[model samples]
Target: MAEEKSRDCCVRHKKREPDQYRDMINRLSRIEGQVRGIKRMVENDAYCPDILVQSAAVTAAMKSFNKVLLEDHIRTCVVEDIKADKEGTVDELVRVILKLMK
Candidate 1:
């Protein structure tokens, strides 16, 4: 078998206002930094409680990120889908909520 070459892709499908885009990206970047900090704490033998606290922080940050994104999706996608008579989006959102709860 020949070597499987990897290809790079630039798929820019999601369109958001500049401010919204910046806000979401900035939130994710902060969460990424928090995750890296947790990795460093683990590598350096940080206290278990301290690490747990930091882990909780990361989890909170992720939850906040999800909340923001979900709000945006509901505000734009869900609302637009409803307006456009695409009722499936509501069902899709219910599935998403169930998945999130689990």
Candidate 2:
């Protein structure tokens, strides 16, 4: 009932299993470190193309992280929402996908 009430309040926060939470946090931590490395490269006057390559690597890593999270959302949140017959979950999912595509 509390979960439903929260959803009705339009502030749904999915409860991630511990393992999933840890994995997501690990990915974000790696990305944060990569960003810090890029900042150091900039401060040290690293070559532009080399910096660009590293930037691209960071972008790819971020996309990979998004992919993992999206897969989990579909497997867990979307599945649970649909099973519960919560209204507009599919539409909300569509909006999210569209935003991601943009």
Candidate 3:
């Protein structure tokens, strides 16, 4: 069942390089920890301002993650697709960037 799930995921997603995958995973782990910390703070009645600051930090971390992912996608996926004359890739990329910017 686990192997089947993995295969299903891979079928619809790009296979990242080992280093890129590791970096993305590490960033997500840290973000996950940060979110749990914020939840704990809320449960423990942390000062409102302090919680807000931590929330902003989480937002920044998320933006940083998105920036890294977008750069990698453009460098690898976008470049490869464009080279292969996939015009739709450009449109797809534009739509994605627009959504991200929003």
Candidate 4:
């Protein structure tokens, strides 16, 4: 039988407080709506340049959000783990970054 590992390795960093989370959620929700709008534009055969511009906007929004999350992870999870000398944490972080690049 495969041994069960602790779930902490997969745990997310401590989340921002409720208000902050709500703000982030609201921003993401708007981005989601924008993406759906882009899909509808494509379905309706909108102008190519217009669709391309909207697509670019969505990509930028997603990248911005990802950057914020990555910064938070580095500040909270990575910094703490490194300070405590937790084995393999840095390697795990590097692997995650490589996956993100792809």
Worst 10-residue lDDT window for candidate 3 reads: 8-17
Residue lDDT tens for model 4, 9-80: 455557687986887898799899999999999999999999999999998888888788788788888999
Better of 1 and 4 by lDDT: 4
lDDT of 2 by residue, 7-98 (tens): 79976688888998998899899989999999999999999998999899899998899889888899998999899989888998899889
Error of 3 at 53 (Å): 0.5
Per-candidate TM-score against the hidden true structure: 0.83, 0.87, 0.86, 0.80
Give the candidate number with the greatest lDDT.
Answer: 3
Native-referenced Cα lDDT, model 2:
0.90
Tens-digit lDDT track for model 1 on 1-102? 133333223221568999998998899899899889999999999999999999999898888888888888899889987999975788989998888777
Can you give the lDDT of residue 87 in candidate 1? 55
Best candidate (score: TM-score): 2
- Candidate 2 local Cα displacement, residue 40, angstroms: 0.7
Q: What is the C-alpha lDDT of each candidate?
A: 0.85, 0.90, 0.93, 0.86
Candidate order by TM-score, decreasing, is 2, 3, 1, 4
What lDDT would candidate 1 get against the real structure? 0.85
